[model samples]
Each structure stands twice: as C-alpha cells, then as structure tokens.
Target: MSEKIFSYLEVHAVDHCNNNCRWCNNHSPFCPEREYAAGEYIPWMEKLEKKGIEYDMISVMGGEPFLHKNLTGFVLELRRRFPRKSLAISTNGFWLGEEQIESYQMLWKLTDILFISLYPNLLRGLKDGGDVTPLLHKITKHNPHLKIDLRQKQTFRMIAYSEEPVEPNTFCGTSECTTLLADGRLARCGLGGYAGYSPNVGEAFRSSKHMFFDLNRKFSKGEFWNWRRRWPFDACYHCDSYKWRETNWKAEKGKRRRLDLELEHDRLAGGRLMALGNFTQAESLFRRTAEKYPLDAALCNDLAVCVSHREPLEALAYLAKALEIDPDHDDARANLRRLRHVLGRGTENARPEVCSADAGVR
Candidate 1:
C-alpha cells in the first residue's frame, strides 16, 4: 500500500439537496435522486488500503447528507474502515431542526468538522431574526462535543459551457482531490462527475476521456493515480468556478448581488492604466479586481479592454460576461464587435440584443 495521504476526498453521500440555492456549484437541485450504498464502499476502501491510497480527510457530503436515512450507519462504517482518517460533512443547516437534535449529536460526535452553510434567506426566517448567536447557543447547549463550521453565504461563481471551447488552467479549488458522486462514479471534481466535462488533456491522456471510475468495477493503483493527476482536466472547461472564468450568459441577473468598495480602487487604477495604453499593468490590475468583483460588468469590460491587444480570445470571453451581466452594456457589445471583427468572425449574424452599461472607462 502506498503511504501517500491525499489533502481531501469528497463523497457525495446524497444526490439531492434540501435547499434550492441558485448559486450551488454542484447544481444539486437538478441532480437525480441517488443514495450512496455503504456496502459498495467497503471493498473500495479495502482496495485503497491494499494499494496504500490514503487521505488525511474524507468529506461525506450531499445535496444534504442528513437527508439520507442510512447516513449514520454509513458514517460509522467509514470510521470502522478508516479509523485514522478525519471525517467531515457539509450541510445547509436547513434540516438540522430541534426534532433532529439527537441525530445531530450523533453526527457531530463522529465527525471532525460539521460544515454548516448559512444561507441568508434561510437565516432571515429563524425565530431570532437571522441572528446565529441564539442558534449556536442552543446547538452547543445540547451538544457541547460538536465542532461547528458556520459558512456565511456569499456570491458563488460558476461558469456556463461555451460554444467555443477555451483551454483553462486556473486553480478551481478541486485540484488534486477526488469527489465520489452518489452513483459511485469517482471524479476529480463534481463538474466532471455530473456533466461528463473535463479539460482537454489530449487523446493519449485516458483520464481526460474517462474522467472518473466506475466503483462497481475493479479498482486499481493505476486508476487511482490517473484520477489524481488529471488536474485542470479537459472537463474543466465547463466550470468557471474552476478558475472564476466568466460565462457567456448571465446566470444570476435577477438576483440581488454584492460588491465591495475596496475592489473599486483596483478597477479605477486599472482603468487609468488602460486609458494610458499600459495594457500589461492594466491587465494585472483588472485581473486582481476581477477576482474580487467577478460579477461586476464594468470591471469585466475594463479587463477585456486591458487584455484585448495581448489576448483577444480572453477579451472576447470577458466582454461576453460583461454583456451577460448587463445585457444593455453597450460598451461591452461594441468591444465584442470590434474584437470579433479583428478575429475575422463576422458580426452580420452575431448581433445580440441591446444592453445597458457605462463605457467601462474611468
């Protein structure tokens, strides 16, 4: 058995989630109903042990892990099988009510981290008016042994599939990790597991084409290593969160969005640099700003301008995102028009509806 310990291994214990969070990167609501069979994991674990495939942490996740009636049994089996590995679970905290306090106790007692995602909309409906202090107090009062991980809601980015594929190498947080889907398909990330999409690594790279393992089949050391090394795999092109890449269409237009004033400075500085024709400096500044203000159409447009001369394809993608965010963003539309023309892509049949946006200039 290899003694190498992986950083993380996420297992989707349940296919469907309790909450229909619009920004869910896992696209849980659309996922088909499926349950992870505990029995199926035993042989797999045995194989891993025999091959020395080890991990420091094992995340038992779901649309909601608690929704599974057999979760406790499965978790206990995992403890018995991988006694030295740390156990964890991620939840929305919607179903962790007073009625399930006992169950929560058993779960929290067994796991190293009880990651609770605090959705603001859900929090507002609480008896204490969205305040977590009382809830935390109640939970701790009942289960002092429980370790809580309260993750406050923020804008979560996701990329939509593009008609024209572009190779992406951005750090998508799933690098070097494995995700076991509910159907026993083990993938490097949820995108590949569900969408059959991954980065284009080349025809010779078998991992790019297969992307995951059929746990029902025989497991091997070669399969494990192949899955582990297929980072930034071809299927990655389907996910923007993999690298915070902008989508061609807006996925969150009607929803209320958040932005920070601190990022405005970077955009302004980047815009100033763009006006001076310092595209390299502007590109760096805008890139930093876009990381913080990804949904901001103005910032995306500015960044597009900065990169237009050096990387027109990237600029086209950015402009597309700008138009998607603010469909009325005329400047972005114009920039897209000009770039497409330079690229020799005809604008005659490429007309988009009028959009509203400032000229993306300082």
Candidate 2:
C-alpha cells in the first residue's frame, strides 16, 4: 500500500451496515455485523511504516461506522498513533440520534471531517420511526469545528450484476480511494475489499471475482502494480454504474421503494433469483433462455457465472460464446479475464484440469 502516497485511506469500522441502500457498492446489505477493533489494524499501519508507505489522511467508515460501540476508542487510538494525520468518519447518520452529544463533542477533537451520506432507505431503516432531523439540529447547536459533508442524494446509481455489461462511462469514485480491510489486506477500493463478504446475503458475491493485497502473505509488488493499472477489479464489470441511467432519488416518505429492490427488467428475472443465491434456479432459467436464444451474449454470460465453480470448462465455453456473439461484451470479457487469472494462479490443486473450451450448445 505504501508503494505510492495516497490522498486518504478508508477503513470499515463495522462489517454490516445499518441501511440497505440500493445504490451502495459496499456490499453492506449482505454482510453480517462485526465491529473491528482498532488493535487489529494497528499492525497493518505499523507494517505500512516499515514498508515506507504513506497516506495523507484516514477515513473511518463501515457498513456504518456508528454501529461500533467503541468507535470513540477506535478513533482515539488512531489519533493517538497518527496524531498529525487528518482523520474523518463517513457515516449514514442513522445512529446520530442515539449518540450522546458529549461523545461526539469528544470525537470532534480527533476528527477533522464528518461525512454523512443520506439515502432514502433511511426512512425505513430508522429505529422506532425516528428521523435524523433532530440529530442534525443537535449537531448544529454544538457548532462543532469538524467539517461537515452532508450530501442528500438527489440522483442515485447502482452497481448491479449483469451478464451483458454495457459500455462503462461512469466515473470511478474510488479510483483514488485505497481501502484497508480488517485482515491487514489492502484493496484498490471498497468493492474489491467487500465483494467476497456478500455471499452471506446472496449468490451474487459468490458468483463474482475480486482481487486484493495480502500484506500478510506472499505477493508480487510488480503484479499488484500491473493489476492496479489493468481493468477495474473484475467486480467493476458487475457494477450497474454505467448500465442503468441514474434515476432521480425519491425522498418522499410515502414513496420510498420497499426494502426489496425492484426488478429492473423482466428478461433479467434470473438476476433476482441469483441475488438470493439461487444458482440452481438461475442456472435452469439461464440454460433454458440460452437454448431459446443461442446468440444472446447476456444469457451466455449469466450461464457462465452459474456454472463456473462446478463446470469450469463449460463456464469457459459459455463465456467464449458470449464473446463470439459480441466481441465488446464487457461482462463476458471480465468473466473470461477472471477465469484466466484464477486458473492461471489456481489457488486450488495448482489449477483445476480444464478440458477443451466449447459451449456445446444445441
């Protein structure tokens, strides 16, 4: 991580988030609750010091940073270690109402910035039907010196799983935001760090590919730099950032979408099933869909994800066919790239035996 000086480093204080925002790329909706102790990450920082890595600032965030009961202690410890470094806490502010003003006042001394991201999901995710307005007022009353970055979402976009990925035009928000995970792993961004954590919520994370830095294990600095310059982590292709147009965020309490994300399209119905980790049903549907539309690149790509673990060769074939139909299919291309990288690296059995690649479709 110290290969280059970073503007700021982001760390998740809690594994699970309080709000299930549809636009979130953090995979928070699917993660379980776990507050990371500051002690766990202290060694990672010490390692960074030993390796000559440098970062200008540290941002404490999480599924929701406020979920950690000892966040003050955690931040206090970070401040104790890096007293000169700028510190920040990014949160949804859902728990602000419950915070003791004195606690935050004490936090004010350690924190330089307080980032609050407001998503419409807060209307429902709030406890006992409480709102953040009172919390906002309380903060305003304190006149805290920490810089406040409160952004009420006006338009929102999502990162979604799609077999047929669209041309990526969306800006990479995390391009410069290197993330540090609790296990002493450094990731290019939040998605890369947290994508693997989502299988607990659904099959989507399980079906996707991710990459990270293992400072605790063997790694190639050259490989890491090369991987950094290459395609956005394979998970980037699964992002709906560019596929779906940004929609106006509806803030009206009565009109907020239910907790379940609405299906964006009927043809991609299998995706919803896949979201629930229903690969068996998704596989059946995708196979049937591919049989009907053999040239459909999207269906081929979906089928590839469904069977990649069991029938790696067949998965390769489906991905190849998807590329054959549309050479520029980013989703299929990403899946193929993942296969090549994984099989080439082969964490298991030094690469599984792969037969010749052929979709063998009727």
lDDT of candidate 1 over 64-168, digit per residue (tens) = 776665676788888878888888888876543332333344455577777888776555545566556666666676557667888766445555555445667
lDDT of 2 by residue, 25-92 (tens): 57676666677988888888877766666678898988777667667789999999888788999987
Off by over 4 Å in 1: 137-145, 182-184, 196-210, 214-223, 245-362
Error of 1 at 352 (Å): 65
Q: lDDT of all predictions, in order shown?
A: 0.63, 0.65
RMSD of each: 21.2, 20.9
- Considering only N, C-alpha and C atoms within 3 Å, which residue pairs clash in candidate 2? 2-53, 17-63, 159-240, 160-240, 203-277
Cα displacement (angstroms), candidate 1, residue 359, comes to 66
Whose lDDT is greatest here? Answer: 2
Q: In model 2, which runs have C-alpha deviations exceeding 4 angstroms?
A: 1-4, 97-99, 121-144, 164-171, 199-210, 218-233, 242-244, 248-362
